[model samples]
Target: MLSAEEIHEIEAEAQHYPTREAVLIDALRIVQSHRGWVSDDALRDLAEFLHMTEADLDGVASFYNLIYRKPVGRHVIHLCDSISCWIEGYAGVRRALAARLGVDFGETTKDGRFTFLPIVCLGCCDRAPAMLVDGELHVHLTPDNIAGALEKYA
Candidate 1:
């Protein structure tokens, strides 16, 4: 499920680890970096390589919010839903985004261009109602400006 280059990269990183179990997160990240998202086959291979049960590895993988288990679009939209954002009109921002993308959180656009997801925070509380589009942070959002900000990603 992993390519030679990916295995080589993962093994090189694994050298610094005390044991295969310690390398769990990095191994999964390596697989995700190469494959976009970790498939069942890839997870199985990783479990074997790490000498851990698939269930154990899956638990770890699922715990990390950044690790995607299913296919995602080219761009991932992470909307902050923390109290600061909530107080700063997060509902309007979310509504605007939902209307713009025609997809709700945990759903991907039908055109496969974007995936909308909710994150706890982006640590931009001063600039509340922030969102990250493919890692580019947009803060102090309003419904009017959100669409323009997303145009670059589209």
Candidate 2:
């Protein structure tokens, strides 16, 4: 359940949107920022708060790729897997990094410091073989760059 203050805060966000329905995404984002994924209770609360049905809220949330409906790693490492990246060395780079980290894609490290995921396009096709770690983009990556890059967050 959301705190009274939290609900009030969300109400302010709700007002900013042209319609209460518009607040659904942002409110769910707020919930995810706090709790990781969109839990059943959070979905129900969001539905009630936004005057939406649970199914309606779920539908919108599921439609968006960025919205995590399940648990994600504390530090998400998104590697670009688009055509440009594939033409580069992203495949080998991804494999080597996974070997070094000892976790498959979408799996979190035991220390919980990292989780590897794939991104369809980083929007930097020119910098094919790029990745985003903790929201910071690292372009033109190689296997050699992985350890040093991981150090920045460590």
Candidate 3:
């Protein structure tokens, strides 16, 4: 069941849209903000609350990579795999992250510290190799700096 606070926030955001369906993303975000990730039950509750079909809401949630449909670690690492990043040695960084975290893309560390995933871009082409760790953008990454960048998270 959706918490009273979650319902209140969703309702507040709903006022800005013409229909509840229009606020689907925001409603999902509200639920995720409180729960970290959207579970199947929460998805169903949200779909019903917004008068949307579960399939429709699920499609939207899955389409948006930021909306995690399953459990995630405390931190999410979104490594950019754009051509610019690739040119700047994204491979080495990926290797370093995988080695250090012991998890590949789309997988979370066993310690529940970080979930690593690849992103199409981070919009820092000039910086080349870049990543967003727990929403903080890290640019000009090299294999050597991965540890320093992640040390603060724990």
- lDDT score for residue 139 of model 3: 93
Find the number of clashing residue pairs for candidate 3.
0
TM-score, candidate 3, is 0.95
Q: Which lDDT tens digits does candidate 1 get at residues 1-154? A: 5688888988898899888788789888889888878889999998887788999999999999999999999899999999999999999999999999999999999999999999997899999999998889999999999988888875
The alpha-carbon deviation from the true structure for residue 4 of candidate 3, after best TM-score superposition, in angstroms, is: 2.2
TM-score of 2: 0.87
Q: Per-residue lDDT of 52-152 in model 2, one digit per residue for the tens?
A: 89999999989987788877777788888888999999998899889988898879889887888888888898887999997799988898878888887
Q: Which candidate tops TM-score?
A: 3
Q: In what order do the candidates fall by TM-score, top score first? A: 3, 1, 2
Overall lDDT per candidate, in order of appearance: 0.91, 0.83, 0.93
Candidate ranking (lDDT, best to worst): 3, 1, 2
- TM agreement with the true structure for every prediction: 0.93, 0.87, 0.95
Worst 10 residues of 2 by lDDT: 1-10
RMSD of 2: 1.9
Q: Name model 1 segments beyond 4 Å from true.
A: none
The digit string of per-residue lDDT tens for model 3 on 73-127 reads: 9999999998999999999999999999999999999989999999998889999
